[model samples]
Each structure stands twice: as structure tokens, then as C-alpha cells.
Target: MYNLVRFLQKHHFFILFVFLEVLALSMLSRSHHYQRASINHRTNNLAASIYHLQSHISDYFSLRYQNTILQKQNAELLHKLALAHLPEPQPDSILKERLVDYIPARVINNTVNLRNNYIIINKGYRDGVARDMGLISADGVAGIIIGVSEHYATAMSLLHQHSVLSIRFLKNDQIANLHWRGGNYRQAEVVDIPSHVIPQQGDSLVTSGHSFVFPEGIMVGTVDEVMESEKGNLNSARVRFSTDFGKLRYVYVVKNVYQNELDGLAKIKTNE
Candidate 1:
């Protein structure tokens, strides 16, 4: 108590001055309209500044909530972007939705070192995913959806020798077939393009979306080397996929709303 009293006494001169000034100002403010307005304005501004500071501090600490909101916003925006790029989904068109109808999945099981390996996703029919769906990573096409359950799905990795994906050149727009040669997981083959098209090195290859599997224009790979066949009119090239199949972690499985109809038609034609 003595220490407190002594400290107050030491600053008492300034404290008294401030107290007297406030008292005079209060009286003057009540007597003069302009002074009252000035006092109120200053008080309001001080309060506003304090409130603004508090709000900013609170926002800075609520990063978890803010991050969740941002993630949701990003997902919604990407969905819309996907819709804008999809095909028109003509009634007779084989491409199902040709738009934003895919579920993002994390790769839980994968294989790239072997000739016959598959991948498992965390999504399934319960998530509106189905079999034969197209699977793609952000960097490029990964594989095709093969089977699905209520809570999970399986993708036929492009590393599978039995897998065949049709691709096309981004430069001359020539169509080709992509298959694994079982040599390198990072590389695949684009085969059977017309020799006349003359594909050059570094040409980009992407999904043709001709079948009911994937959307058109999905990135597949790039032509790293073009080999002219001395025996036939067919040209073969090595493609470096936008995605590293061996290092795949996450993927998106595309669902065509009209996949059944498209596949049925194809089956009917085959029967015919």
C-alpha cells in the first residue's frame, strides 16, 4: 500500500493535470454544441479503433476455421471450372456428364514397379462413384475406375499391361493408343498414329475421351521420343505422363451421368 501510494504521488502532478483538464472539457462540452460534437467524435473514433483491432486479432487466431472455409471455396470453384470444360453431353454423345461429376480420392493402395498392379481409392458408390470411371491426378491421367464398393473403389493403374488408353497429340491432333511396355513406370507408349502426321518430340498427349471412360482433354502424357517404323505406316512414340504413376498420391474419379447409356449403345453395336 505504501509503495502504491508513493508511486501515485510521484506521478500525481500529471494525473491531477489530466483530471482537471477532463473536468473543464466536460463542462465546456456541455456548454458548447461544437465542443460536444468534437468530444463525441473523438470518443467514437477511439472506440472504433479498439473494436477494429480486436476483430483483426480474433481473425488472425481463427486460422483453422478460415482454412476450412478456404478449402471449401476452392473445391467449389474447381467443380465449377470442371463443369465449364466438360463436353456438351449430347443425348447421343457417349461422354456422360462431360462436366463436373467426379469425386476426389486418396490413393491408399498403389503399384507401379510391377507389370500388373492396381490402385485403391478412398471413395466408393456411397460417394457417388462407380466402376469404369476415369481416374486422374492433378498433373495428368492416372488410370480408369475398375470396381467399386460402398466405401471404396479400385482403379486399374496405367502400369497394367492389359490397360489401354487412347490418346491424342496436342499439336497435330492425331489420335493414338497409350499402353505400357513394362519397361519404365514413368513412361508409356503412344502407338498407331498415322505416320503422315509427323509427331515431333515434346508434343503433349491427352485423353481423347472417345470411350465412356474419361473426359476428353484430360492430360495423359507428352511425347518424349517419336520413332518412325521402317516396316509400316504406323508411328510409335514415348510419352511422359503428366503424372508420375509410381508417386501418385491423390486422384479424382470422374462419373458420367450417362455412362450406362453410352456403354449400352457400344455393346449393342458390338452385338450388331
Candidate 2:
């Protein structure tokens, strides 16, 4: 108490000034209507200004979140664009065409430097994410879901050793199996392409949509190598993957809303 009194004595003049300022402000707020109105307006303006400043800061920090939304929107729009350019489904088709569902997800963990690496995403069952869904980025397809937990899932990257995506050449449009040799990080193999089509290096390839895993026309990559398969029946080539798994920050998991129906119809056709 003695120390407090000593400190107050040392700064008494400044304290008095502050106390007088507070009392003046209080009087203005309580006395004259015009003064009170002015005070209220000024206070409101200050509050609004602070809120506006805070909003700008919040938006600045949320750019990444906003980008995730935009990326998902882009994926949805691109999927629709690809379908729009495609021919109508067959008259006897069982499943409806041109309708694909998309679940936006962020790549929480990714690795491209190692062979047989898997990617982890920031979505799971709660978000309707499930195993076997096709995962892709804006530049191109990434991989397929192979494992799932309650709130997380893992994907077999396009560069994984056992990864296989039904793909085809874009120029001559020869169907083949896309695989990785588990060595190269940026390269994929397109096997069983008939040599009659004259496969060329740098030929663009995309998803064949022959299976239930991925829809048609998702960009995979360009042909990086062309050679005769060991079996020698058909030509084989290596495709430089479109998405660089090492640099991935965000991606989308494709959910086919009518997948069950489509898969059933596809199975029926294959059996026949």
C-alpha cells in the first residue's frame, strides 16, 4: 500500500489528466443529447472500422481455404465440361450419363520422392469419401483410394508400384493399362497399346473410363516413351504423369453418385 501511494504520487499529474478525460467522456455520454448522439456515432464508426480491418485480415488468411473451394468448383466444372463434349450415352444404357459427384479434399500428406508411396487426404467417411474413389488434381488425375479409416484415407499414387489406371492414347485412341515400374516418380507405363495405331512419343493420354473407378477423359499425362511390350503383341509406352505428386497441396476425390448402378450395368455388358 505504501509502494502504491509512492507510485501514485510520482505520476499524480498524469493520473489526474486521465481521470478528468474519463469523467468528461462519461459526462458527454450521459448529459447533452447531441453530445451523447455524437459519441455514439463516433463509437459505432470506430467499431465498424475495426470490424472492417478484422474482416480484411480474416480474408487474407483464408485465401487458402477459399482456394480449396475454388479448386473443387473447378474440378466439378471440368468434369461437366468433359462430359458435355462427349457423345450421348447409348439408348439402352442403364445408368444416367454425364452426372459425376465430387468431394473436395486437401492433400495433408504426400510423397513423390520414394517408390510405392501413398498419399493421405483431409477427408473421410464423414464427408462421404470412400475407398476406390478416383483422386485428382486440377492439372490431372493423381490416384485411387485404396485404404480408408473413419476420418482419413490413403491413396495409391499414380506412381505406386501396383497402381493401375485404365488409360488410352489421345491421338489414335488405343486402350491400354497405365502402370508404374516403382522406380521413376514422374513416369507411367501404358501397356498393351496395339502397334497398328503407330504410338508416338509425347502423345496425350487420359482415363479410358472403361471401369467404375474413374470416369472418362481425366487427363493422365503425355507419352514419354514408346516401345514394344515384352510379350510383343502390342506396343507399350511410358507416360509422364500430369500431376507432380511431390508438389501436391490440394486434390479432389471423385464420387460417382450413380456408381453402383453404373457398375452393375458395366458388369452386365462385360459379361455379355
lDDT of 2 by residue, 182-234 (tens): 76688877777775766777888889988767888889999887887666578
* Separate clash counts for every candidate: 0, 0
lDDT of each: 0.73, 0.74
**By summed lDDT, which 10 consecutive residues of candidate 1 come out lowest?**
34-43
Where model 1 places Cα greater than 4 Å from the true spot, the runs are 1-100
lDDT digits (tens) for residues 1-272 of candidate 1? 99999989999999999999999988755634322322332212333344445544554554675466447657977999999687665555443325547678766667787877677766777898766678887677888766665666667788876688888777777777998889788888877888787788888888887876787888888889989989778988888877877666657888887777888898999998
CA lDDT for candidate 2:
0.74
Error of 2 at 261 (Å): 1.7
Worst ten-residue run, lDDT, model 2? 34-43
TM-score of each: 0.64, 0.62
Error of 2 at 50 (Å): 36
True lDDT of residue 140, candidate 2: 87
